[model samples]
Target: MSPAGASLGATVLCVLAWAGLAAGDRVYIHPFHLLVYSKSSCERLEKPTAEPAPHPSLTPAPIQARAPPVDEEALWGQLVPAAQKLEDGDQARVAAVGMLLNFLGARLHKTRAEMRGRPGAAVLSPTAVFGTLASFYLGALDPTASRLQAFLGVPGEGQSCTSRLDGHKVLAALQTAQGLLVARGRAGGRARLLLSTVLGLFTVPGLRLKQPFVQGLARFAPVTLPRALDLATDPDLAAEKINRFMEAATGWDLGSPVMGLDPDSTLLFDAYIHFQAQMKGFSLLAGLRDFWVDNATSVPVPMLSSTGTFQHWSDTHSNLSVTRVPLSDNAWLLLIQPHRASDLPQAEALAFQYDLPMWTKNLSPRAIRLTVPQLALRDSYDVQDLLAQAKLPTLLGAGANLGGISDRELRVGQVLNSILFELKADEEEPPTESARQPAGPETLDVTLNSPFLFAIYEQDSTAVHFMGRVTNPLRGV
Candidate 1:
């Protein structure tokens, strides 16, 4: 117990403690390390040889700027003259066909751009392009066997075009284009439908004579044309029939919905066919049932308030009334904003809070309107006058949550569930003695489940437009 012995022991303890702290800090501060694979093998490893010298004619040329590709311009040049000829007899049909073709070409360009990691332009939405394409085919395009075979380049016995290089060339080009579209992952389902439909129209006996379109329109009325009767009444059945035709025509099972389709694959197939038909100036709606309208149902909601004063707050709001609409089992409370007071913060807040969650991934703003007073005197208005003048829809629709909200109060505005929490190794706990046990085949299992909210918002503003609760949220969200 001498004083010098005590001091020396204390100094040793302090040094060890400091060293441990430094190690802990280093662990926390360390940069992430990425493992890189070595190119060379251990056996017979050698440095790479220098690249072969360029040929005399292929020597490094001076850099020169080149004009951007003008594929669209060239396509238009070929199309305009053909369109003019078609217009001579059926001007409306020709115009419709031209629009469909334009849409198809645009879709093709968009798909190409997406494949090459380019941003898609907003000039044409995919739905509009596909819809228009569908319309053109149903409205203007003939389903004659000769025309169908010629357009698609499919060969048949006694088909003289198949024997020629020109026929083969066009057929190869069409197939190549179709293959490229089918490879795109986003639009597979629509593409599959389009391709199957086209093939059905072409190869199915008597379909080219317009019976299928007539049947399809009658069955699926308003969404599809009735030119082909067989396809109109039972579109899904028609799709199945088309599948059979494709199998017969190509000698391959193109696969059926009964067999599970990977969603990504389906999207690519759908996009391919849609783009192709569009390119050929086909109208999707001409013979198809109105999917959007047919699928929509009036959602129901509890009446929160029914004060007439609320409705008559603005002149625009005078006619506004509340109504409920269903969005799945979940009822949506849609408060249609009035035209004059549409920009009011209160209206926006109400819509964002209630409407967005129920209709997330489905509903979109139907319209937007603005009004400005010309005179300064007119601008100064009472609250009652302003409210009365508001033209927005006062109607509200309600729906069920559809597993969107948790019982627990979540972190305000936190859009994602399952927030990652790093439990750092305890700094102060003493290391435990190593325990050993008899070892054999062992199984380790882990399970995690947490309820949390997710929100979708405009990219620029952090304001949440849509919110939902994830029951089985994906990992690393």
Candidate 2:
């Protein structure tokens, strides 16, 4: 996959601040986290001719305070209030997470662009990838540590504890935002959301890992476990064991057997995420719809459709249309489809730009009839290869000082991220699902009939949680 540009080629160390810093019981988080503050693109979409222009954003009326039911320990959620309002800490975390999200979005885009029209869907998690890097940050030294701290959206650094942002706080904030989305329906007098992140460290037998690294990982994943592997004796067996262990740990097979463990290495790092959301007011079309894989190719797919007041924006200059389709109470699946099927790569590249937040501008509320293919993506990626594709090969490539991970000489091996993303109404019919939203021909129809890009973002933090593209809807996830 091709990279963004030469700027993206900057060494990971340049982003690191190793000045007079040492490994400690601290993690720094940059405070200014928001990536897009204003619109700076083709044009500020004006009013639509066919109907009254939709509101710039679907900002609901003021929400009153109330005693909301939510899992405080694991999730930050409340009733009555909408997600637009952000707290100081949450805002900072949003910016830090946003940067990582942009990077990951670019990675997803490159992968799909490299293999266009592949018979599978692609997905990635912003927080999960960031968490893995956080583990690295936990073991970093001085200038590098400081650079990571700032990159992660932690601002101000000094000898004083007051100046540094807590790494645990940043990780917790991301987890909370994720939980808030998946668990939103349950808190709002509906059903529970199914989402979780897991981090694992598989090391060669008898290897000792740093306590701070182990403990810091807890902030990112609910279940942070470190296990043993024998890559030297039998690399293939070791790979099989690791794969089975992950499957058992996450309750889902990785599909592909874990391969290519560096026998000389003593440690392997992995992160797993499972994010699934059932649309509240959606129903699958009675029969499969014809989705065009290309101008000459079409396939049948089970499409989900809904009708509601949604935020809509269109860019004629770029020849793209976007709509904020509600996935969960605290999250919106921002769907971007090109006016022309061949324009997908261009639209995807544009989406990767740092100013993507501007793309949501000038959108107003409109009654929309939305239909999209169900996305069930379960995939794993080698972090090393991913970094290379992102044009920062050496970020985790050669000369990576992962000294913090172990007390003895160790070769890093198989840094894989297992991501699972699924969306649907529900398996069993509730009979009332269809009636949840008014459906008719009067609404503006926004159907994803061809290749498109989509991202799920937390409304409050404005942080993109998941992103990917689908070319053939009929392809199994």
* Predicted structure with the largest TM-score when compared to the true one: 2
Q: Which tens-of-lDDT digit does each residue in 102-165 have in candidate 2?
A: 4444554465446445344667666667667666766665444554454443443343334444
Question: Candidate 1 — number of clashing residue pairs?
Answer: 90
Tens digits of lDDT, candidate 1, 1-477: 544233333433443343355456333211101001123221222444477332121111111212222232232233223322332223332222222222233323233334433221111122222222232222221222222222111222143322211222222222222222222211222221121122122111121222333332211111121112132344455445434443343332224421221211100011101111111111111111111101232222111111111111122333222222221121121233223322332333233231232223333322111110000000000111111122101100011111111121111110000011111111222222221121322311111112212222211111121222222211111
Error of 1 at 249 (Å): 5.0
lDDT of 2 at 231: 72
TM-score of each model, paired residue for residue: 0.17, 0.74
For each candidate, the alpha-carbon lDDT, in order, equals 0.22, 0.61
> What is the alpha-carbon lDDT of model 1 when measured against the actual structure?
0.22
